[model samples]
Structure formats: C-alpha cells, structure tokens
Target: MIHRSISEYFSPYTLQKVEVDGKEGYVLIDREGYYKGPDEGIDIALKLLLAYGDAGIQKALDDENKSIHLENMGFDFQKTGRYVRHGKPVYKRGEFDLFKRVWSFHCGFCGKKVSIDVQPEYWYIVDQHGIRKSNTLSDRACSEICAKHIWDEYLELWLKNNRYSTELGK
Candidate 1:
C-alpha cells in the first residue's frame, strides 16, 4: 500500500503500487524510461534521491556563490538516521520536510506506522547492527516491547563480537 511520486526526487522515475506476478509490489521507472519492479525498485529510488541531493550539496559547498535548489537544500550526508537536523540554514528552514515525506512509513519492527499526532510515550531507535556511528538509517519502534526486542537482539550480537575480540586479545 506504500506508494509515492518520484517528481521530487528526479524526473520521469515514479514509485507506485503494482501487481507483480499477481502479488502487490512497487515499481520504479528509470530516466531512460525503463521499468523496474518489486520492493527493491522503491529502495533504489530512495538511494538515487540521496545521491542526487548529495551531489547538489557538494556543488554548493564547493562554490560559495552557488546555491542549491530549495528541494535539494537541506539534504546532508553528515547527518543520518531516522531523522536528523543539524540546524543549518538549509535544514533549519525546511529541507527535512521532503525527507519526512519520503520516509513516512510504519515501524520496522511491528509494521505499524508511528502516529505523529498521538505522541506515543514509548518509542526507541532500533540500531539493529550497532552501526549508529555510520551513515545509515535505523528503524524506529512504536512501543516499548518492540524497542526492547530490538535492543536485546542488538546487544546479543554485540556481546558475541566482544567475546570474540577478547578471545583474540585484540
């Protein structure tokens, strides 16, 4: 049921719900007008948008006189995760709005979209791979139970890695 337009990301490419082999899925069209299918198509579209936005940011950074388009303004690489704001001009203004629209979805653990209006008291950022230090987006849990599950799983793996490192005396 997840569907979105690609006009904000780039030209021609669109992400829409479609029947793939009689099952519900998403589709992504390329700039060359080629059709790609399945959920991965949507994922690819997101990555493409990030890359394009990064390029624009780099361009503006390289030249003081140059300015990035309003749509590409607040897309930053230094800040990552479910939602991050460094409070810069481009970000402080309204750049993260576009990202929010694209990332508007349900909790990764329970598949329930966290209602912004409800303001649930229990919520957690699920760093499954312990890669929060890296430039990768982590999942958000809507409830404390889901959050605990995510943390426990991550901790188990982290402990195993620690044990192995200690055994190797590294």
Candidate 2:
C-alpha cells in the first residue's frame, strides 16, 4: 500500500504490485494510459525528491522499465541492446531535438543514459528485407568505446547467424 501523498505526487497514477526478476515490485499505471515501473514503488517515490523539477524523469522511467518486458519475452537484450519498429531501428543517428523534447537514450553497451545534449551514434545492421538484424537496442552510444563495443556485438551476431545459415545450406 503506497502512502497518499506519494500517490498524489504522481497524481492520477496508482501502483500495482508486479513481479520483476522474480521479486515483488510495483508498477505505476494511470488513467491517462501511462505506465511507469515494475520497481520498488517506494524507490520511485523517493526519487521525486532528487528529480529536481525534471518532469521527464517519469518518461525516462517508462523507457527503462520497458526492458523488463522485453527480457521477459526472451529478447537477448544484454547482448544486443536494440529495439525495432516496422523492421527498422527505433532510434537513428543524427536524430535529436533538445529544444523540442527530452532526448534520453540508454547506452547500447553500458546501459547508462547518454547525455541529452550530445548527438549519439547509432550502430546496426539492416538485412535485405530492411529488417535490422542485430538484437541490440538501437539507442545511442555514450562514447567511442561504447560505440565500438556495440559494433563488435552486432558484428558477432551477424557472423554467427551467417555461419549457421551457411552450415544449414550445405
């Protein structure tokens, strides 16, 4: 049961207990059709104190929590940090507008939030069908090292898949 003030702080939203990583956690759901967590409900409430007037934190939490669902669906999320939409990567290089909206991306390698102001580099492989072949998330890399790491993972997946297909054909 969450406290009343906490509920109002995230007004119009309510908490629902849900299992995460085999443990009990709470997710925030709202009438407006927004979903926020599968985390310790109290933890999110406490974070509000540190949010420092950043309304975007709620959206960020929603984005991060999405990984839980992705993993539950058997996505090799850790190996390839990618998500696709309409057979294309959800995020693209050189696509950002800080003035228009908060641009927050989880680093492909480290899982840290990429700096909002920095233009992030995207690494992915598109197959002939225009489907992205990598399982990694299509978010930005925080640095050259992270970018290299993402590329290496994608290249490895591509090579492994190609090897399997070649073997099966013979």
Candidate 3:
C-alpha cells in the first residue's frame, strides 16, 4: 500500500486500497492542502522530487521520516496518487506528472485528456463543452482547447479593459 502524509490532509486522512480498471489502484487523497510545498514558489523543485516515481518518492518519504524532529517532507505514502485537497467529486482532473506518468493534452475547448500515443504531442487546451478542438504546435504543442481557453481568457481581459464599466457611475 502506498502511504503518504500531506501536511494538507487530516491525520486520519490516509490512502485507501481500491480496484480501478481491473488493476491495482489507489484512492489518491483528492482533498485540498494535499501538498504543502512552498506557495507560489518554484514548481520545479517540488515536481522534480515527485518525478522520481517509486524509488525517488520512497527516498523523499524516507528523508521526511528522518526529519521528524525538524522539517516534515513529502510523505509516507505507499500509494501512487498525488494529494488533492477536500477530495471533492467535482470530477475535476489535475496536472499529471510528466516525469512519472505519461499524459495526453486535455483540449482547452474540448476538455478531453488525450493519450500520449493518440497524438504523440505535449500539452493541450480543452473547450467549455469538453471535447477535442485543436492542439498546440508540434514544436510548441498544446491542445486547441487550451489555446481557446487562453484566447477566451485573453478576450475577457480585453473586454474588461475595453468595455465601459457601469460601476464608473459610482
């Protein structure tokens, strides 16, 4: 069993064993505070540690255990899933670890996480409707959905700045 402790989880909130797709699977703590690394800090440091997979993760966990009296580190997790705060059933997916797990880009417009084999590309953008739309350029590949999402987000910013604000009356 994969055992990990997130500074974000309840002391009792632990990993549970469950079958997924007829294979050995773990119920990752989908709760918030699942990760307690530095906030708004360099993501590379944290992700680099996690990229180690089983052996690497174990070492980190071991290191954390060694520092019980000092700084707490990764976790004692025997499972293979990352921490998610609250574990709510928003059915929301998260950024997968490319170092450890292979992933397909989820279209920004479509919201479909494609398999790496399907496109052999990098990340993607999803759509509001959760379907495949476009993909990032091969050299700089991202999904069309993500592209659109970014576009929409940009447009919203543009509109916000360009559009007249009624609150200006106040």
Candidate 4:
C-alpha cells in the first residue's frame, strides 16, 4: 500500500484570505503548500479559485459515479523533447505550426487575433482527437484566461451531450 498526505492527495491549490503589512487580500496556496504572495491580484485569484473548485467537484463526481469519464474527454498530451531537472519529460498538447506560413485564428472565448508569431497573442492547444472536438471553436486563444474560457465552454457542452446520451440509453 502507498501513503499520501492530505494536501498531496487533495488539491494543490487553495485560496485564503490573508493580510500583508497593512493591506488585506487573498493569497493562493501553491502546489508545494507554500503561501504564494498576493501579487496575482484578486480578480485572477477568484477566477482561479472558481475554476479549481469546479474541477474538484467534477473530480469527486467522476470518482463516485464512474458514469462519465471526464479525463478521456480532456486534452491529449504529447511528449516533448524537453526535460526538467528531475529527468521528467515535458508534455505539451499541440505541436507548434512551424511550417513557415503565417497561420492565424480568432480566439474562441475572446475575439482576438491569435497567430504563430505575434505580440500579445499566441497559440493555444485544444484536444484535436476526442469526442469533444469542435470545429466552431478555435484551436488557439490570446491568453490563458481565454484558453480556460474556451475549455470550460467545451467541457460544459461535452457534459451536456454525454448526459443526454446516457439518459436516452444511446
């Protein structure tokens, strides 16, 4: 049998109301269980908290119900050549389109130009090979926020579809 700490077994991210100096704000507990400074700002922190909360709830439901496999509906990771100091290979979702021509797409969440080579906007990856794959959604976004929004929308749609299928016994 294996052993795991509560923090390790549970989520690595936590939101806490904290005070620094004379100001009060929220701080995030990072993966290492260390208090990350409040430099992430309140809005982003709240958004991250909501996203993580949704993820945790979904995880629990998935574990207990087992009717829906959300992991199989998520991203498809590919091994990259890069490795960390711990000898673990870095994984990425989509290969960079480095075929010489300029490829661009509008962000699925925010209407912004995303290109292979651009400032303030770059490539984002969506699961290309999955039941949740969408042609209407762009494969790229301008920022992490937009990317998360796109993913959330996709997941919502996928869950709805799956629920309908299971209910209808299809």
Candidate 3 lDDT, 1-170, residue by residue in tens = 23556763454233446687898744434346353333423454465466665566776665555445212222112331112112321123344455777745445455555665565454422221211133343212245345434544533443345442322212
Q: In candidate 2, what are the lDDT values of residues 4-92, reduced to their tens digit?
A: 36556556767777898999976788777678654645566777676745767776666555544444433443454444323344333
Model 2: residues with Cα > 4 Å off, grouped in runs:
1-96, 117-131, 134-137, 164-170
* TM-score for all models, in order of appearance: 0.28, 0.31, 0.22, 0.37
Candidate 1 similarity to native, TM-score = 0.28
Inter-residue clash pairs, candidate 2: 80-136, 80-137, 81-136, 81-137, 82-136, 82-137, 82-138
How well is each residue in 1-170 modelled by candidate 4, as lDDT tens digits? 22347765676567777788979866678777787665655656687587567746666555535423532333222222111112331212343456667767777678877665665345354343454545554756677666655655654555476662322211
| Residue 148 alpha-carbon offset, candidate 1, angstroms | 0.6
Off by over 4 Å in 3: 1-100, 123-142, 161-170
Best by TM-score: 4
lDDT of 1 at 24: 98
Per-prediction CA RMSD (Å): 20.5, 20.3, 23.1, 20.3
The TM-score of predicted model 3 comes to 0.22
lDDT of every model, 2 decimals:
0.44, 0.51, 0.39, 0.52
Q: Residue-wise lDDT of candidate 1 within 1-170, one digit each (tens)? A: 11225665345566567897899976777777678765766677687687666746555443432223211322233343222223331111111243254443455467776554444333555233232333222244556666555544444454365332211111
Error of 3 at 97 (Å): 11
Worst 10 residues of 1 by lDDT: 87-96
